[model samples]
Target: MASRAAAVALCCLLVLAGCADSPVPTDGADSPSATATPGSSTAIDAPPAATPKPDAVEVEVIDIVDGDTIDVRFPNGSKDTVRLLGVDTPEVHAENDPTEFPGVPDTDAGRNCLREWGERASQYAEDELAGETVTLSFDENEPRRGYYGRLLAYVHVDGDSFNYGLITKGLARRYDSSNFQYRERYGTAEGIARGTGTGLWGACATESPRTATETPIPAADGGPPLWVSEIHADAAGDDRENLNGEYVTFANAGEETLDLSGWTVSDEADHTYTFPEGTEIPPNGTLTLHTGSGEDGDGHLYWGEGSPVWNNGGDTVIVRNGSGETVIEREYGG
Candidate 1:
């Protein structure tokens, strides 16, 4: 009886061991911490890094001149006029010069249409950038200022290029894009703008670009056939020390020789230089007038001023015939 009872007890122990829960899975999902709560997590993923903005000089816009121009005030109490680089809007001011508009018809109606589009461009800029803080960037290959004495720079607002925005919106055409750093990017945007008929290209009645058939004759009425071709406003060093480095270049686009005798070249400050009686520019030739005193020859004239004549900041070049009629107007720098 005692042996049988012991045997039963041993069997009972074996059965009890077999019925116990398999060893708790401590290494996996069955572990007490994992199974107890799926609601909590302590790990956190980090955020991505932010991109850096390029360097630029911050300035406040004082006024909007037009679609492509604006007046800005620097941190110093000084001010300047800035011409939007790499883009040329339709001319609200250059109404009489129909030829300036490449595809616009050479008619009163065409010029009117062009000016209307210019107004729209101006309004757009006013609405967006008027009196706002905008940054400016210069092109290393181009002049810091134009012949007109306006600051030549790319305007940036809210980290985007306003100059490029104008092109993509069709408000302006690529002005002097060959030397521009973003020429290819601008060209691509221009193609898309043209295809979509964005702004001026869509609003104005534009014709296909016409090929030049013949040389355009000068105006029969003695209108000045001269235009400001180039201006070296800033010198390598100090402008006052290096006067010859700063100069304005005038070119004759007419077929006939131009007699600049008695014509006065003046700046916005009214610092005037009257060409000597025999100053004649041959057709398709250029006459560069330097700021420093030098014997005038070799397609060069001298302004004969000790101090700088053109302002490196901003100014306009006005050329008028003896009769005081404004003939040539070229503005740059700011």
Candidate 2:
């Protein structure tokens, strides 16, 4: 009887085991697929892939010079100036011409209005490119460097061409020259921007009431005894060929004749021109210095450089005393 009872118990246990739930179905995806391996975790989560960048050369921005110029450092640890390809901004310096910027009237107020627009464009570029890492694309046909030894390139910020953006916004024109590859596309974008009256196009539509004479150039304080009244950096022709065309005008505002013995005038590039021992300017008199070889006169002097001295782009005119003390420092834009 006990053996029969044990057999019955075993049969009941088998029946209960057979009645258990079947294995849940999973189409492989929902299943725990990790197979524990030696020296590896059973559950491994793969990291996400990183964002991809363009195949172009990358550069770190050192400075945003203006609307269309930049200073950059390459991966090889070299620094260079990059002039944005296929674009031209308004002149921020003293020189302004209505013919350069279309639709602006050829008047003092109109030029001043354009200058204001130029300042706005510069500010906008600063906002866009300040400390931004960018990529560079070259025009295969044109030379790598421009006349000023600045690299000619299309700056890519986040893969979009910043040069094109400038044209689309009317911050710049489609560059005066036709050397670049994207001239057609850039021209089209510029037309659209011009039609829509964007940026400079719309901002300078009307002439400002304030004339150029109304806004006299402010005197630069802390300069040498002589006051720098004017600077003509961009000459009429090729600056290298016409060195004497680029000159600086200084005035003696005092009542007595001033002696400038041992004073030196230097540019940002350290091209210095020293005043002669007997250099003197009479009361209420003026003097002009040219950047080429010439015979010195009562109020005229020369620097006698083989090439150009003052930077047409922009520069700081520094005047030092005989003892090498900085008596004058003046900075200006091109």
Candidate 3:
């Protein structure tokens, strides 16, 4: 009877041990059967990591407020209004603010002219900015962030620059006190436009007006024929030896064909070369002159001499007509 009781007790103990070893489902969602194996353990499954996103390029057009101020669009899809630096167009506001002598044409004609200038300037801006990626940098002195919390950046477009173009065309005047990056270049272009009276200056008649005078050249349906715009010294090596060669290039800015026969290129030293009889420069084409040349080097004029006559460091080159009148005179600074 005692032996029988011992066997029964041992069986009960084994059953209790098996129940303790079995895994219990922690939550109804997970299966109790799914568990780590003994000896060699299994790893818990985890989610994949996420990839980071790239930075955005900032750009804005704000609005074509007048000819200078524009609405800038921020990277966060926010809009901020900005005034352009280094240029001031004629005010279109209706303050009736009158100047001392040659005030802005308050008359209908003057007002109309101002409006036209504004339209042209806007068109130029669109031509420059549309479909381009840009970065906005603001002037330190000017409000870096406008009242609306928009970043005011000085626009640098495609590396060529547009501020200078506006000033050169007399569309905008220079703001001297402003720390404009292209101030000098813009100032120079403004001076040239004012001197030439290309745009608004041509309409104004006042002497010593608010703006400078522009000298008007008669409108030419076609511009000048083939004309040389640049010259460079074609010397090779450190010896600085005069390669006995110089080149004169001609550019035809007009639409008509320019015959090159009688045209001559001469230096102040009187070394002259007449164009070959049949040479012709098509509309908007370039013609080069060279000597002992195997085909013109890159189509630029090449004059290969046993010794070069034109000074390598610098010298004056003149293009002339058959009549000996000067067409263009360039001093080669190279």
| Cα-based TM-score, every candidate | 0.45, 0.45, 0.40
How far in Å is the alpha carbon of 140 misplaced in model 3? 4.1
Q: Give lDDT tens digits, candidate 1, residues 1-334.
A: 9999888866654443232222222222211122211211211111011111333456788898899999887654457787886678887776634465446577888778778888988999999999898877665435544545455677877767788778867787776433544554455455435434567665553653211111122333565366665668887799989999999877665557889889899998899999999998765466889999999997899989999988878778888887877776666755
Which 10 consecutive positions of candidate 3 have the poorest summed lDDT? 41-50
For residues 50-162, could you state the per-residue lDDT of candidate 3 as single tens digits?
A: 11111112355645665666665554455555555556666555332223113345566666666666677776777766445544443323433332333333455544335
C-alpha-based local distance difference test score of model 2 = 0.64
Give the 10-residue window scoring lowest on summed lDDT in candidate 1: 42-51
Model 3 residue 149 CA deviation (Å) reads 7.2
Residue 109 displacement in candidate 3 (angstroms): 3.7
- Model 1's alpha-carbon lDDT is 0.66
What lDDT would each prediction earn against the true structure? 0.66, 0.64, 0.49
Residue 214 Cα positional deviation in candidate 3, in Å, after optimal superposition: 7.6
Question: Over the stretch 1-334, how does candidate 2's per-residue lDDT look in tens digits?
Answer: 9999888866654442232222222122111231212211111111011122323456788887878888887654567777887788877866677776667788887788778877877887789887888766555435545556566667777656777778867788777554455564565455445544678777775532212221112223432245565678888899999999999866554446767788899998788889999988764456788998899996889888888888888888777677787665766664
Pairs that clash in candidate 2: none
What residue runs in model 2 are displaced by over 4 Å at the alpha carbon?
1-55, 206-334
Candidate 3 runs further than 4 Å off: 1-57, 92-108, 130-132, 145-152, 176-182, 205-334
Model 1 regions lying over 4 Å from their true place: 1-55, 96-102, 209-334
